[model samples]
Target: MPIDQLVTLLENESIREALMIVYERSDGGTEELEWRDVRDALSSEQWGTLIEQEVLVSAGSGFAIAEPGRVERLLGGDDPSEDAGTDGIESPSWTTADKAAGAFALLLFAGYWNTGIRDIVASVESAIFGPVAGLVPFHLVIVFLAVVTGFYSTVLQSRLLDREKLEQYKQRMTDLQERTAAAKERGDEEALERLQEERMAAAGDQLGMFKLQFRPMVWIMLLTIPVFLWLRWKVRGGHLGTGETGLVVPIAGAVTWQQSLVGPMQTWLVWYFCCSMAARQLIQKVFGLRTGTSS
Candidate 1:
């Protein structure tokens, strides 16, 4: 602790980043701290008997100090040199597993919808070829799965990016704190310098970030619609389901590839969802990311 600066209150948790912010005073210099180690620094001094006997100084509220550090171990370590193709490790944004799972589940729902849509065709063809009619049922299922898969694939990626945004917000809060602290310690002039320092840093950071956007080049997302349609066709053979068959495909375009596919798709979605939950857990465990229900 600088003789001029003393620790103040701690800010609440933000998404993803490990670093947290703490309030402290300094001799008018910048004291911005973006860290995740605040909890370790915070302490209660209510039970000090030895110092209690003497006259207490009005030194404001005394508490444990906080530090600036990362909350997550993303391994990239502020590095800009790396292959874009993330093989074994999931891209914190998108994963093949997530794409596969969502695609399959949506396929099943599409099949169900297709089944009902082509019921009339099924009934018409049932007399001639019962087995062949069944083929049409599968297409509906595949289409549903494909649509859902694509939608959720993007959803997952968006969420991951959202975490990054929150992390930036948390960093900003920290910078603001440090500037405020410097102002407290150095009166008006030095505080202005601290604020200017923060502005320059932020301006520079923004320029670099503009080039790292993850859109307009990921071909996988564009491939989803056609893939979904193809799957539907493959499952149904040729016939598309209709809305008349309330029992099979309650909705229009009820796909009916195989009743069994539904189970697998549902299971896969559950698993992918679990993956996101696991990511949250990992962040919390490693970088001390706090949750809504907890501190």
Candidate 2:
């Protein structure tokens, strides 16, 4: 039975009194309740109504509350259906550090299009990475950056994301969907309507889920954008020598770092992307880190 109907049933004075009597006599619904046991307090009509509504189903010899825990909760004045999906899950709030990181990440993102910001970031980053670049070819430098970014990205996601809470949120929605389907199959319009209302109320969970997934991205962008700027500076500022400017990649064979492999994506960016993906997968496998909720 839907909680709404159970609530409605409790509104009747006679039904409420009868339920109280039955609950008390049955030891909080631990034992079966026969009509004869509460005959003095409950009227025939109330007993018949309880049976008709299926609130009490036949046990081995007598009737018992169909769902004792639900009945107990309702009687205790708690509404289980209120905030169905967000019952135990707290809303994710961004801390001051998180907000600061996001703000800084946004500022860094401007370097991608603004030449002055790009040069400043590249100049600052080159002081740190330039020595490494001087030793290895530019392609190897790109691979090294990819591995570093991939490792940190995975670690940030694992630490920042609340995997258990995410799983709970998903499981609650899945359970609601299954209940909705069952109600539809049974042609229970009242139950279906209640489930639909619950589903609508749970819609705010989508935003909560989004916040959970995006919390780590700000940190990632803050760390990654500077390395990208440095790579761009190296290519455009004639930092790469004759042999370091090109690479023999898998599909494209030999291609210059600045050559366009995809629609606006340069060869270097493509290679970095491929390397980042492979490195991320390997890191996750080796460390048993999970960035997403399990099925």
Candidate 3:
């Protein structure tokens, strides 16, 4: 729909409903106008400068606005979690090798992301001319980046491992918006279809987030390879006393190949336990996640 029609609807539509309409019309499946963004996009004069901006359409005490990045993220743009919610936890549901492959892929991602260190180093290369005082070597750079990545990934995986419930919450919010919009349009039996769309979309996304994020090997458990590397190099080596060079050799070695799962339980479950249990607990604690009722 044109921005003008959106504004006409925005005048009377609830903010959430307006957002849903925008999401529906958008090429991709998401929206960039978070509540905070809307607030920021508007002026402080209460409802004063709204329509004048052409970005937002003020409705009956509520509104909608044009969002710049709606399609990108909805279509799987930047947020890693976008796919993480759908594609799965680093590994597929099927094979043992899946997890291992995921670990390698993730590490590769880390390496690739850090490849720019070369540019960073080359920029400084002309400034440093000694054999040992050389600009950061590519291998050393990769290792350094990997180690940092591993630490962050491990922590992130653990955090998201149990996000199943949180995703549901997002789904519900989305659904509620859609249903209310249908009530407005009263578009016929098809309106019921709209409600169905709301229910399914919300439920599916919540389930997807839950399944992917809560998986043991996908999230915090992702730390395994990184953790193992750290353990092999730093924790068990007792080289902290040796300082910088001590860390250097270990990080350099990271260039070599590496390897697992974190189980839900501490024992018997093996590595799978590492992340599974964390995911379960996360879902339980953050109880308010989406659980859209089927219409």
Candidate 4:
């Protein structure tokens, strides 16, 4: 359904004032207006709303009124009696699928400590990897698993995350910080107090950011845990015959897969992580995959 443009423009006092400012500065919609022209008169929220609502459209160097005739008509009419509530930061909610995946991931995590779960997962996975294990050394199998997991993990994160929304959250926080610092420098207690209130409200955005970061991790874990359990079973269940268990690693020289190299971390786990990190980095560079927020 189309937005009730008149209601949207007239409902919020800040948006109405900002629209008037833009109209005057743009010479009654004949010209375009840039942020610098009205930055002092309008807040970031107001400016964001104008762009989001499609009231201001991209016009070369800046923005112009999307529908000058409709804006003129709305401005000339009586104000809306019901004032709109203040807009809060909209945090993304997890879908039912995401929750389900997270639950399964947690259950899979228990396989690391529980021998019953570990054995079951390993037995199931052996049917798939047993043929390959027969052809290559166990260390090569670890390398192959690491590379496969790394590729999918990187792709999943790039596809699942909302870079634009994360950027918006960052921009809002940066704007607030800059304004707060300026208010402090000028010793404006009133502006400082107001910015503090805005900061408190924005605290929820941090949790939202965390949620966005962790959503992909749940899926990654769900896929990775089974592989890990299978590897653990292979190492501990005496599946490795004679020389297959030993691997030569950097600094540590020759070490058995079961040998503890770093604190409680065994040789296989350490080797797996090193291979995974290198493969993930190489895959990202080769494919131009982005996992971090854009600048």
Candidate 5:
């Protein structure tokens, strides 16, 4: 299934609820569930969509997970048998020592940033840009931070999400979808239905991959927020102050009180977003962080 279609299916409240109900009743096992298990949670339209989308299919007078192994793995089920594609060594399950080490590392990062990184970043910004109005160069500092954050975020995502693994999941989904289409063309309704269910399971795996990819950002924000606060504090003075809003295009120019895509928003904020988005792509490419199929 295309990502957009899968996203639309997953976004439906009733469908989401129905999936949850089915998952609960199945107890992460092979137990089949009748429509009665999810009927209350799903509307007729939702049920129809699930069937049409191959997210649900008839099985022995009831319904079972389209691809139990894939679905189970996507849902992060504890059972190892749920995902044959996954290797034990590639799992994210951390030992107690690993958890302790991670905690210590985060604490150290926080302390280091609060104590020295702020001053160093500010100094570097000033040395490069020569103070573009505020206590320090606001745009320059933010842009630098944006690049730093982008590089680190990409690294974290690559390490944590396992791009190659996600690519394999996507490939499996594509193969299943092709098989489903072939079955439908050959008038094999039973095969088609089964294939559709399997395709849906692949969709679940795609969703899981997305979740894992984004999880690193949340963890990164734990450090990002404090660093942003420090930067804000450092930039609070002179004519520009923190209240001043402006559009800054590197090597071009800056304009205060200018309109952006959303009219009348803070120019600096808009500029930050624009710069961040562009910089992330550039950094990702430069670092060879572009995971073709996975992304």
Candidate 6:
């Protein structure tokens, strides 16, 4: 329907109020509203207009939303949980015991793989530069590790997240917000109220999407924490003594007054942070990872 026609229909406070009531009642099946409930608010003429517009249909003793799904969508899409009530949380009902067993096996394999990688990583470290200047070889290894971790995490996150669907929901919520503001500006109290209700429902959906996005983090962290601990042991050699640079930068090898970027920070923590930040962007691009704030 055209905006003008919709506005004309809704211009009547009674009709607007009736629609809101019907929308609120419109759930699983077709919503049925009796004349007694809305008769005091809406006149026979207004009710007839609504019926003629096909927004409402006679069903035995009451009227129901004609196309409940479409109207609900226009009112702001229904919550996905309305049907299944999962609220974006993963349902274990369909996950068979076999699938659960497979996941446990995968987790065990990851633990074993991480333990075996330490020696291999050390070999890679030794071969790369064959004992370069103070911490330079170690720095190279740190960069390489950071890049690998970045790529792995980004790809895993993308695989776990329904980013396209999340983005679409966000866009729709934003559009609804804009429409709500327009209604408020025009002093359409009924429309504003209905839009606000819709926006709140959309917010719930967005929260659910965000929860799904982080669902993979539990698995990722399980593997990553052990690997990082090993890296920490290698880099710090189980301890950090003063005046020992973890990774020395060749160009500005020493932390001088001129090189304030690092600001006298010479620990593995700082090195890892710098490398991770630098490599994350490149790795995200290579893996086609999405970077954006969830609404």
**Top-scoring candidate (lDDT):** 2
Model 3, 4-36: lDDT tens digits are 343444454353343444454432222223334
Candidate 4: regions farther than 4 A off: 1-89
- By the TM-score metric, which is better: model 2 or model 3? 2
**Candidate no. 3 TM-score:** 0.24
Residue lDDT tens for model 4, 80-107: 2211111334578899999999999999
TM-score computed on alpha carbons, candidate 1: 0.28
Worst 10 residues of 2 by lDDT: 79-88
Ranking by TM-score: 2, 4, 6, 5, 1, 3
TM-scores for every candidate against the unseen true structure? 0.28, 0.73, 0.24, 0.70, 0.47, 0.49
Which 10 residues in a row give candidate 5 its minimum summed lDDT?
Answer: 80-89
Task: Count clashes in each candidate, considering only residues at least 3 apart in sequence or on different chains.
Answer: 49, 0, 28, 0, 0, 0
- Supply the global lDDT for candidate 1: 0.35
Candidate 5's TM-score reads: 0.47
lDDT (CA) per prediction = 0.35, 0.81, 0.39, 0.79, 0.56, 0.56
The TM-score, computed over Cα atoms with residue i paired to residue i, of candidate 2 is 0.73
Clashes of 6: 0
Residue 271 of candidate 3: its Cα lDDT? 24
lDDT of model 4 at position 79: 33
**What is the number of residue pairs that collide in model 4?**
0
Residue 154 error for model 4, in Å?
0.7
